[model samples]
Target: MSTLSHDERASLADALSRVLARQYGFASGRRQNLAIAPEQLPPIWSTLSELGLHAVMVSPDFGGFGGGADEIQLVQRQFGRSLLVAPWFQVAICAHAVARAGSPTQQGALLPPLSDGRAVMVLADRDAVELDAEPKVTQAHDTARGWRLEGRKTAVLHAGLATHYLVPAVTPNGGTGLFVVDSSAVGIGCHLSRLVDGSWSGDLRFESVDAQPLEGLSLQHHGEVYRSTEALAIAGVTADALGACEAALEMTVQHLRTRKQFGQSLGDYQALRHRVAEMYIELEQVKSACDLAAEAVEGVDSVQPTRGTAQALLVMSQSATWILQQAIQLHGGMGMTDEVAVGHCYRRMLVLNARWGDTREALARLRGDGMTKEMPGVAGS
Candidate 1:
């Protein structure tokens, strides 16, 4: 979408589809919780890196595929298709931050290893919700050895698995600065926890953490990075929601065809059919909005991103909730159990809605950006 030529889009989609088909099956197994000791992640990480997942997100200057928001959305949709469990989302997003802010020397040192999956990364921000909020916890100070970072960030995705973290902190001069810190640093501590979708995140505390600042980093680019990253995130999750909704719809359709009640199949009932049709209509609407949002975020240099991503999240989250709810209701009791597909889809929807902001928070953001509505809900990472 946006400035991407039709050929670029088609080639990218075709490549991703072919490479992910096998990994997609593995992801499905993980989502279903069918495998014992399913935590083996090195192979999964190696596969994604080898397939050029990280390369696709990186800039061409850094030996990357030079992709942007469109690529982020398409690949994320595939991840959503299988609920793929990997640290790739964090790695690509953090690497993007480095490419945008790091000096040439830093970029050359960092980007290649990440491209080949030899390193893992994640991003940590203090105020992930409000664009206007200043960092209260993490701050940096001048030190003879370099810069010393001190603060805490909770709910960091892939905190334990990452080899390094891209942390945004408030400088003593009242400006936000981005820095890279080794995960093995002495003063850094991490408290692990599980998310609703069965993924891991951590609460990190930094005490006198020595870090490498991105040379030539500017204040304007700091905000831009956050906005850009959030846009990419929304795009990725939108694709994921599309995949989950599609899968759930398929499951519901299959059930309707086979399950009989009142001596007739559910497909033979008019009311259920109407509900299914309504679900399909909403899914189509969300699918369209997500595509436009990805396009807008891709051209974020010119497009107003807050409005587009907020609008997309609002539409997708609403439709996802309703669609998954209908899928569960139609499937009856078994839909509530982990033995079925729709149940996992429901969990994923819950996690996605909770990410950043849900439907209500999205509407509030849209309103704050000059759209009309009453305000409500809080923001989080």
Candidate 2:
């Protein structure tokens, strides 16, 4: 199916804004946190599911809305504005991976529940643990009766809430394989932790945990699956960062117009005005980069667009952090307070900076020759 047109996206964004305003009153100076209590999730889940948002990444045949990177990005931006705490990113990315990699039987079993919002799935990739030197899964194997998983997966988002987890593990033969593990199984326990943005993560322990091998699923050929997952995350989180930056910029602009100093509005001062103008310019740059990244992901075949995608993410991360910091400084001490939405947006930007890959990592990947080898036409010398 074709991607949504600009008009469709704008309509969807408007509808989402109405839903968010009615449900959370987010734009009314209300500070929403990332830590969501169990009781707070069901209603929001119902709303998003009813709106066909949760199924955006799944294919149409699998009972989904049949969306691509652009649609997912639009929903994520709205989610960011609302400060939603659901496992949306996890579920969407994992569902895409499964649809691309899993066997027909596996897809039949997993995609419907995910599309309907009856269950959630998380990616159990431990690459983040290497950064923190935390416990991470080192191996996986197949037993006579079933698959056995032995590894420590750390910083799994929404692990406590998901019914199952899609884990990437190194097999004995040294190939990477995907395994599905039931969260309620014996030997599977979640150690919950708080992320810097106040969101929840978990350290998962599996000692010979029973798992079902993803038969017929392979990462071999094209390597598009992994790249697609990363591209989705970059595009999705960039939308979130855009929302936060826009919110902060709007708040700063409003404050400058009303807050008085020297018998005039703060916005009247040349120096402050210049700073606000700079913030606006930077925000626009980031938004443009986000759009470019989304387009690169949408038109993946001929372009070999990984470099452009990484560059977009790098620019977005840096610009977002800069804008938010300037916004905080402009708002004075109130920006540092928890009562302010700008402070929360700042925290969210920091979190998004580290998700998928940080600026340094994205740059390093872009500079490397590995990604360019396959996309020969676009490869940098």
lDDT of 2: 0.74
Q: Which pairs of residues have clashing backbones in candidate 2?
A: none
TM-score of each: 0.86, 0.87
TM-score of 2: 0.87
**The candidate that achieves the highest TM-score relative to the unseen native structure:** 2
Candidate 1 residue 351 Cα shift, in angstroms, is 1.8
Q: How far off is residue 203 in model 2, in Å? A: 1.6
Q: Each model's RMSD to truth, in Å?
A: 4.7, 4.4
For each candidate in the order shown, give its overall lDDT on alpha carbons.
0.74, 0.74
lDDT of 2 by residue, 228-298 (tens): 66577678888888887887888899989999978999889899999998998998888887887887776
